[model samples]
Target: MQRDYFDRVHFWGRISSVTALAVMLGIPLSISLHFGIWPQAAGVLNGLLKIIPMFWSIAVIEVLTYAPLLGAGGTYLSFVTGNISNLKLPCAINAMQNAKVSPSSEEGEVISTIAVASSSITTTLIIAVGVLAFSPLLPVITAEDSAIAPAFKQVVPALFGALGAGYFSKHFKISLVPIAAGVLILLVFPALPVGTLIPVTVIISLLGAHLSYKHTQKKEKKRQNQA
Candidate 1:
């Protein structure tokens, strides 16, 4: 039964990912056809040359970093729907924590997928409603001097800070390396993109965790010997 479930998940995940890619590509193609104005080969190549390097690297990094925590189904949904970092990941982590399931377990896969799916649906509905009903408030909301501008600016930071605090408290030693490295890197190269920093910190954090675990094991072995 477990094998059958994973088989079906893989089948549908691949299908949906491909379909999403096609729909995304089809949009610009359709627009160009309707206008009878296709971009020149040189122009397209130039644009891709500028974009592909950064985006391609980040795509690979995000997949490697997020896949384990998200599980197969959740990873597929998060990638397809976008906003993995700020929304889907947080939702999935919170759900798994609540359900008391490890990410590698079958229960975690189900919970993570459900969390991501629900977030995607809720996001879509919110966007639709905002577009239809809040169009008039866009100017107010976006104005630099608006009353709520300060609060809006802090939303992403506040969300991440809250999540970071929880995780850091749980894994203080392992978290220190990445936190310090990230701060130092940003201070040294302020222009560096956040996407580029993600994988660097992830690598550093993994190394830190490995070393911490090994040290703990060594101490345990020494204590056993003394006893």
Candidate 2:
């Protein structure tokens, strides 16, 4: 049954990913066709040359870093719906933590998928409403001396800060290396993009967690032998 379930997931996941890619490309293609304003090959190539390396590298890194935590279904949904790091990821992680499920387990897969789906739906609805109401709210939000300007700018940082505080507080030993490395990287290479930074931090965190686990195991073994 598990095998069959996974087979189905892979089938649908691939379908969804390909379809999303097609749709994404279709929009620009359609626009060019309708306007009869196709871009020059040289211009297109130049743009791709600049962005492809950064975008493609980040794409691969995100898949590697997020797949283990999000499970198959969640990953497919997240990649399609977008906003994985800021919204879907936090939702899935919080859901799994609340449900007390391991991400590698079937139960976790279901929970993560559901969480991502919920986040996607909520985000879509919010975007739709915001679009409708944006004109009315724009003036207040964009006022030169708006009191909430700083707060608005801090939203992403606040979200990550809250999540980081919770996780780091609980797993300080394992988080130490990643946190230190992240700070050092920022200090040394302040221009590093977040797409590259995330995977590097994740790798360091994994190594730190592994070492911490091994140390605990050795201490337990020593105590058992002495007893």
Candidate 3:
């Protein structure tokens, strides 16, 4: 009998997922609080943030664990067989296998994917709700609006900028292609609905990845020929 993949994530993976979720949420929250906007909604925001660890525990245990292990077999087959179409088969098989005992098997792996996606969405919604719910209470907690509210709103971009800076610092010139592509997208984005930005950004990023991967392969071949 096959053991359920959801039950099989190593202890370390749970720890990693917990750490990732904390790091993801904590940085933005910390930045917002430091800017003083948090005090206004401190009670609600703190309560919501505190609950995330528990939520993450459930998501990691019930959802994301299978995608890596069972999906790996499919990925390997796709690579060796040169048939990328078969990639989903393994993921589907794993999902079905796991679903047999899952409480909501009717929802299946799509539900798991949505659960993982919802984690990010839920975090954003929690912050938005906290701000909206506590806006009236701000006067009681603070002297005035000042720059704190704007700074709090800036947390998402600031967090992303810090991440991008870190990546660029490590990768250097390799990051330039994506940076250029992003600039191009931004330039054209004003003419298009905001929804188009995401797909364009994704395509540009993938193109950058492909170029970088090809460059690395070529460099490796050159080094091998020199030796």
Candidate 4:
């Protein structure tokens, strides 16, 4: 029954994902057709050359990092909707925690999907409302001296800081070495671009976590033998 459930979930995930891809691709094509305008081949190639290196690498890394946390269903929805780490991940973690489920389990998958989907819905509604009121809100938010401008700039960091602190507090062993590595790298190589920094941090963090886990297991086993 569990296997069948996952099979169905994966099957539908593929279908919906493919459909979403088609729609996204179709939008650009439809706009080009309607406007009877096409970008110059050289310009298009130049643009891709500028963006593809960074964006593609980050895309691959994001998939690797997020797929496990999100599971099949939530992964599909999060990829389509975007904003995984900042929004979906924290929300899903909180949901799974509340439900007392490990993220590696089926119950975790279901609850994470529920959390991510609910977040997606709420985000969509908020965006729609924002759009409706954007004309009035825009000037106030964009003004150079706007009181709320700093809040907007700080949202992502605030969200990440809160979530990261909570998780790192719980699993400091896995996170400590990587975080230290991050600080050292930033200090030593302060000029690393945003694109390079992200994937580099992820790679370093995973390696550190893996080594830490092994050391922890060894210490625990040694303690058990001594006892």
Best by TM-score: 1
Clashing pairs in 2: none
- The superposed Cα distance between candidate 1 and the true structure at residue 158, in angstroms, equals 0.3
Q: Residue 112 lDDT in model 3?
A: 39
Can you tell me which runs of candidate 1 are displaced by over 4 Å? none
TM-score, candidate number 1: 0.92
TM-score of 2: 0.91
Runs of candidate 4 exceeding 4 Å displacement: 191-195, 223-227
TM-score of each: 0.92, 0.91, 0.40, 0.86
Please give the lDDT score at residue 36 for candidate 1: 98
Query: Higher lDDT: candidate 1 or 3?
Result: 1
Better of 3 and 4 by lDDT: 4
lDDT agreement of model 3 with the native: 0.52
| Candidate 3 lDDT over residue span 1-227, tens digit each | 12354334334345655676687689879998888665557777788798797766654442333334333332222222221222232334434444543323434534334333344355567668868998887655543566566676675577557546655776676677766776777776657643334345545666777888899999999999999
Clashing pairs in model 1, backbone N/Cα/C closer than 3 A: none
Ranking by lDDT: 1, 2, 4, 3
Per-residue alpha-carbon lDDT of candidate 2 for residues 1-227, written as tens digits (9 for 90 to 100): 29988889999999999999999999999999999998999999998999899889888989988999999999999998888898899889988988988898989999999999999999999889877879688778768679888887788899888877878877877877888999999999999977788988988888888888999999999999999
Off by over 4 Å in 3: 1-3, 6-135, 138-147, 191-195
Between candidates 1 and 4, the lDDT winner = 1
